[model samples]
Target: MNPGDRASWNQTANADFVLVGLFGETKPATFLYMVTFIFFLLALAGNTLLIVLIRVQPRLRTPMDFFISQLSLMYLMYISMTVPKMLVGQVTGDRAISASCCGVQMFFSLNLNGEKCFLLAAMASNPYTAICRHLHYTLLMSQRVCECLLSGCWLLGMSDGFLLTPIIMSVPFSQSRKIPSFFCETPALLKLSCADISLYRTFMYVCCVLMLLIPIVVILSSYASILRLIHRMNSAEGQRKAFATCSFQLILGLFFFGAAVYTYMLPTSYHTAEKDIMIPAFYTIITPVLNPLIYNFRNKDFTGALRSTMQLGLSPRKAGNGRA
Candidate 1:
């Protein structure tokens, strides 16, 4: 195809390309690909194990587990959005992603963001129930209630993904379509649009500020109060245990919030492909792996439950009572 013909074709179809630029040149393509592929595999395995553990262990059937499951599922989608494109781009240096691919990436990315917000909010509420209203915990956070909350989070996230992605992608742009990021991140996509992005930018900022900012504020405020309440406890063990609970959630929240703010708030005009990819990697990939390890595995209760479940699975003599 001649240059003019190819240009015409490019306008109609999405071009696929790799977005990671490790050095000034592309000499490290193989190394970058291998590193990314390894992380992708780790993330997939870790999140998968978390989901399976949550499902099989009846002791894990709590509100916290419900949110943890959602978070894992979102991370699975998070890795789904970026890893395949990077793999293809890495193998062949033709790292160009077409418009349709961009749309898909954008949708999943937004959905995951929304889901993260909802899950965090739900998590915050779970602690409040246990700490503030211990007597009514079971009644207030019944199975049906927890299911409704989880379903609402998913539905809200899907709605946000569908509504906002199309609005951004519909911008008329005949020139300047090189996305610097590994995937179609919101800010990067906006920067590529030919249309005036002022309003859309404002909208995204408001949505993010409301969704992210408010929840973070609420989380921090709740923890602050919880800390004071814990300090007032006369028993040394009570204080230690309460501090431990607060610390776990606080650390996880900080990681999630810090990575998110960095990714979303950076001026798209100033964003580098490397930074964009790295920030999301922290939140979506690393955080998911850490969530179960840090929160669930470290808990003595969960460990005991896991051991019991394993023992139950290994009880072969009990199985002899059943018909072959």
Candidate 2:
């Protein structure tokens, strides 16, 4: 596949490749489809409610919550793009997609992935400022700053997807264009190319490392510093409070990074298409569903805010009687 000369490009027969279910058996695939569908619903509902609560309540309008609300929205968008195709593919048994369809999938997967990485980095930085530099957190993470950071994240993510577009276009898709994976991943797309894919492989490897690995490193480093700073607090009560703030992020970050690296960083030989679907479900479905509940329910302020929201809606109207 690595010969760079254009003379080597040869057309192949259009053979339909049957896409198999993810786990090892057909029975389990049906079970997993139901389970994943339920997870998709929970993830959507939880994240949507999180956004509504954030927007409807004025007291939740801090810099951190603002970014968190954006995070929830982005997660919802990301999952929505991937999960439905997966369900349809599994249920209807229509595995193959047109070249344009595959291209769209690739674009969204990369775009959402890069943006989510950038968002997590911002999320980690949010607490770092609040914990390490409380006095200057206001100056450091203002509304303007938050907007600029988020804008930069979206731009950087789009840049990564745009870079992939030209390379993906040049690849000659043989008559047999079926991708084995549930969704279109770049590597799986690369395998279908009749053209030499060495350059594309090289490009993807570099981008993945930069967009994925570097962010993971930055997040881990930021959290390490946070933990250290938290440990150094003078009072036990202050330390406990700081630990509570940092713990949710650490757990969610670990789950996101762990599943991602496991899915993408492994050798090509290890990548049977069956493995791809399961790992993505964790970050996409499980993370979003868990994020709002874990973050809000654990926090005292947000719990009180939620309680207030409930009470506000339930207050009884005054009776017409003057002195009952």
Candidate 3:
């Protein structure tokens, strides 16, 4: 082959994959991008505040709050994985992502997604122990137990990344290096492979089912038991408070797991380009923004903690001003 032809071949072999961003360069797309950027900011700030509040406030340092802080950390990491790159691509018009970098992104995204699922399931134990095993809540969910559960979730999540990333990245791509979605998601990357992936697709479907199904079972069973206990209680206010505490967790689980089931558990034949893009967007972009607001903003404890933190922050300033 000639020098130019060889160079062309090398380019084809090593070229970075280009991302088709979430929006186009039209007016509405611009508005949507702006809105998304704002959501990113809100998610970042909200999760950060929750983590800080839980750490600094003694009253908020229960098993449930410990799980909430971990969830906040997961959301913080999750949004950081995809949104910033997408926003930069929107602003700079440079959408090329190196294959190795794409693999790294996919690994972290998958790991965090798995961690959130397991963490949510683990969180269900808190409410169950709190209400049903009220006397033993502390003994059941001790600091040691909580730390072990957290460690288990992290290990399971990392195992998911380690298992899936290499398998997906091992496949050779066709000449076209464009990924249809905004990030290096599993489905989008698989669609670009030149090889037959029917077997791998089936394998992935099974993996997704096990990954999603196990936690879902745990969550449902835990909640069902809690519901039975709540129903047996005579005090109306007690029932209401118990229900309220569980509801936020149920809502968060529904949002995250429902979107995940739609994205990963369903048959690929049922997936359309538009549906694929939009559903993942709900979890990846919108859910992070909703988590902190739904989980904490409505909670009296969180708001009280926020008020106390604000007072503490302002007290020193007030004292300084009085002296001046």
Candidate 4:
């Protein structure tokens, strides 16, 4: 039962974990490889550019973009938690991962997911201050306050992972080590355990609801207030601008949270592993890529900066001047 003994460890399912990635059909592994490679490239490219633009382009140095920069950073970490290992799987055709490594992957993925949720809520507050309290927006979202928000997000997210990781890790996965899902999610990993995890399921569902629902509720309420403020505005240009800024973020929050809630909040009796593998990939891969795409495509400030950066072929000094 000692974890370090590889020979004896190989005799038990608990010592090693196998990941059943997205492609479970007759299609070549290259098909999934190509598809994942494209998305990985897109996610990397999109988020990296957004972060650089926000950092280098003075035009993007605003209250919203500050939080967006953090979000982009989280997206990068979020994708990193899963994608590289997946690419390795594609190349080696070896889905085997050490149990300890599986634990590490699960912990970070959950941690980043929690961080992302908090970032979305913090972002919602940005727009609420913008449209609802235009005069006070700058004063309210000061450097100190932004730092505080960012710090709190990291702390809250780390606490969620810290609390959940140990509890889930303590479960005995003696029955199986093969996880049907692409990544090491709480639900999927729980399914591998031999003991009765009904209580654990209930515990996780509660955690999921509290962490996911509260942030989403705050986001929704903020948007509703934003909409009301925008509606009362007499300037059509300002109204359109306000709506444009928050719309993509709102869409992103809803889709990621909705899918996450459906996947994690439901009781185990309701769904099977066969149905679970398909769900996380969409949120994990597709949503991250969409964040930058939505911003670059729709937000004029972002697109303008992007265009200018392209025009200058990414001259850092000129772009940072806010007029490339």
Candidate 5:
């Protein structure tokens, strides 16, 4: 590498970053952090419960439930990545994060966020298959097919992290090391660069568009097919059931993708410090807490499994007999 590039790398490699988190040191900020912590706990409990219920219940061993469980797992990992550090920073009054730690955080965040985009699209296929192709549903969404789709999501998502993190982190950062957002989001980190990043920004923009566009097209088309099939159904009951099956996923995809588009796809001219902080908080903090609740309350199969698990847990006699 050239001496100029080596110096820039050295500066970035040794730099320590301070995160300017979501709130200030005012009483209101303290209250907000408390609320954030509460949401984090709820997300932790809810996703964990959903995963356990899916695992232990034979009734929930279908392709739909499998996708939901994976979604829950992703939510679990996503929130765990950012919220704890934010909370810790809040409590200790230390928002300093090392450059290495920041890159690592950005890596996983990109990885999981990308994975979720495709995963949601893959999940939309379940309802489309079930509603629009009932005869071929079993064949199309078999366990093998589901596994392959999931593996593809993981691989594609990880590729984003692996390809982009190093390039972004290697660029020279401004001497001012404070990141405006609560987490090491790519956009926020880009603002810290001292170099002219116009070319890289355009490249990143194209990458983000492709990452978002492919899954979005898949999801929209899947839903459109499902809607057409539902419209043609003779029974209102069948239509309601089909809509119910898809409602949670549709809601989730909207919440997730809407925030993601705002964060990554929008022009830099539209972004302010507050919008950057608030928007990421919405998807990273708020959505994870809501996902499990939406799935659990709206999903009869999931609720039934949860109820059964609770009953089994509470019954000493049944538990003992099963163990014996």
Candidate 6:
């Protein structure tokens, strides 16, 4: 095979890879299966409820809520990428995944992760518009604008997936086919490759910086501006409200983006295969639960919205869409 033929390398080189470990859907632990099933149910319930509330509750409609709904949708898709696989493996104990399927899985997981980063940045922009330019916010963030932002998020996510998956899959995995974790991810899949991946590792770092760091900077800047409004306000109620919104945005960024940057941006020297499994598991499986909790708890308005919508019971009345 010619060293320069990337296509041929990708087509023929991945046969050695066979997924194992973390349950293959044949005969998994019963207790583990139940627990994973419960988590899957929670993720589905929480994200689906959030989306429904955003849609059915007329009062919950706004640019921020729009973004939150998008986030919930992303959470649903994101969790589906891995949790179902885990659930299936638990029920059947069949952990076998082909190399092509592994590439596809990593592509989607990474794609949704990128979509999330962009969505969070868009979420940050909402409060900044509300606080920094209160009057013009409605104009600035009209439906068309929000639609554009969302479309851009998906486009960028697809680009991230398209750019990285093939390259990573092309790496020569000459020996073990068994991946260390439940799902195929960039770091773990790269680990299976026999060839030196220094160049790709560097590329991963750059992508991490772009995907993880840049959004964080955007979030911080938005919060910084919002915090100014909080401090300047003499009314305790107004200050608290401003602070609450800022805190949620900051927490969301820190929890999700921070974890990603630490996992992906840091040098390969710092990572262990065992440790890598834990982070992805937390963010992928655990964070979906946390996303709803964060919005519900840290932002009191969401709790109030939920209560209001529950009371209305899908009446679809043009009332009680009251501001939180």
lDDT: which candidate is best? Answer: 3
lDDT of 2 by residue, 1-324 (tens): 556433344433223333333443466778888888898898888788778878888888888788888889888988787778778877787765555666677787788778888888888888889988789999999999999999988988888788986677567766566565566666666777765677778887778788888888888888898889877779999888788878888888888878777666666777655566567667777898888877765666677777887877765332323335
Order the candidates by lDDT, highest first — what do you get?
A: 3, 5, 4, 6, 2, 1
Q: Relative to the true structure, how large is the alpha-carbon lDDT of every model?
A: 0.74, 0.75, 0.89, 0.82, 0.88, 0.78
Cα shift from native, residue 237, model 1 (Å): 1.0
User: Whole-model lDDT, candidate 6?
Assistant: 0.78
Error of 4 at 76 (Å): 1.0
Q: Residue 237 in model 6: shift from native, Å?
A: 2.1
Comparing 1 with 3 on TM-score, the higher-scoring candidate is 3
Q: Candidate 4 lDDT, tens digit per residue, 257-319?
A: 877887888666777666687778877898889988775656788999988878778677666
Off by over 4 Å in 6: 1-33, 297-324
TM-score of 4: 0.88
Clashing pairs in 4: none
Candidate 6 global TM-score = 0.86
Task: Compute each candidate's TM-score over C-alphas.
Answer: 0.84, 0.85, 0.94, 0.88, 0.94, 0.86
| Runs off by more than 4 Å, candidate 2 | 1-25, 269-274, 314-324
Q: Write the per-residue lDDT of candidate 5 for residues 39-125, one digit (tens) a residue.
A: 999999999998998899999889978988898999999999998999999999999999889999999999999999999989988
Clashes of 1: 11
**Candidate 6 lDDT, 1-324, residue by residue in tens:** 465655646655656344443433345456666876788899899989889888887777788888888998998988888777766765575667777778888999889999999889988998889889999998999999999999998888777788899888877774556777778888878777667889998887788778877777888888888888788889999887777777766776677876687677777788776567666766777778887878754455677778887767755543545432
lDDT of 1: 0.74
**How would you order the candidates by TM-score, starting with the best?**
3, 5, 4, 6, 2, 1
Worst 10 residues of 1 by lDDT: 16-25
Q: For residues 1-324, write the lDDT of model 3, one tens digit per residue.
A: 579656655666567998888875566987899999999999999999999999999999888889889999998998899999999999899999998899999999889999988999999999998898999987999999999999999998788788888998876676787898899999988998876898878877877887789999999999999999999999999999999989988987898899899888887788998888778888898888888888888888999999999999999999999999
Candidate 3 global Cα RMSD = 2.8
